[model samples]
Target: MKRVTGIGGIFIKARDTDALREWYSRHLGLDIADWGGVAFRWNDDNPGAVGTTVWSLFKADSAYFAPSDAPFMVNYRVADLHALLAALRDEGCNVIDRTDESEYGKFGWVVDPEGNKIELWQPPEGQ
Candidate 1:
């Protein structure tokens, strides 16, 4: 099984999310929306194949990246969240004990050796 298929998203914590969002929108032309993020559509040439990569900024005090003092987190696309998480556990990685699922897809987390929380996602079928 492939450990990581691709980067699903990159999340950064900022002291002032609004200011950072404005900076990215004005300087980087990111089209940052009210939600403080943008989804970049995958330009796949293959028919019936589509995907997107998400970029977002979170407030400095946000607990989303909890258990880690890092200011950033990376979400990785995975083919099978359950299997991959199991493998990480067997390999002695500090896998988080909780999982979440929604219309978006199944989600799980694991903290790397350096204590950076990593998000694993299995996108809903056809996403």
Candidate 2:
């Protein structure tokens, strides 16, 4: 069970998502997309690298990072979201009882000991 393989994304909560996105773009040189985030492809540095690392901003009022009042959330790439989630549940981890699937792939969540929500992602095939 190779748990977390890499970071899928880093999400930050801000009072104003648009302003924050602009700041990140202007100051950090991030190419924020119209979708409100940047996807850093991996193959550029490692030929075998697959998937991307996403950086996005969310409004502070957004409930996406709910159940935990943290201002940030970290999404981690996983080889098997279902299996890993099950393992976490069996281990008494605070695994959320929900899962999502779309063109993006399967997604699940858990709250760390410090109450920070952690996202687990399994990228779509060929990603």
Clashes within 3 Å, all models in order: 0, 0
TM per candidate: 0.95, 0.93
Residue-by-residue lDDT tens digits, candidate 1, 1-127: 8878878999999999988998999898899867779988784543576777899999999999999999999999888999999999999999999999999899999999999999999988876
Q: Give the clashing pairs for model 1.
A: none
lDDT of every model, 2 decimals: 0.91, 0.91
Measured with C-alpha atoms, the lDDT of residue 86 in candidate 2 is 94
lDDT of each residue in 1-127, candidate 2, tens digit only: 8898789999999998988888888998999889999999875434764679999898899899999999999999888999999999999999999999999999999999999999999988766
For residue 38, model 1's alpha carbon misses the true position, in angstroms, by 0.4
Model 2 earns a TM-score of 0.93
Instruction: State in Å the error of residue 102, model 1.
Output: 0.5
What TM-score number comes out for model 1? 0.95
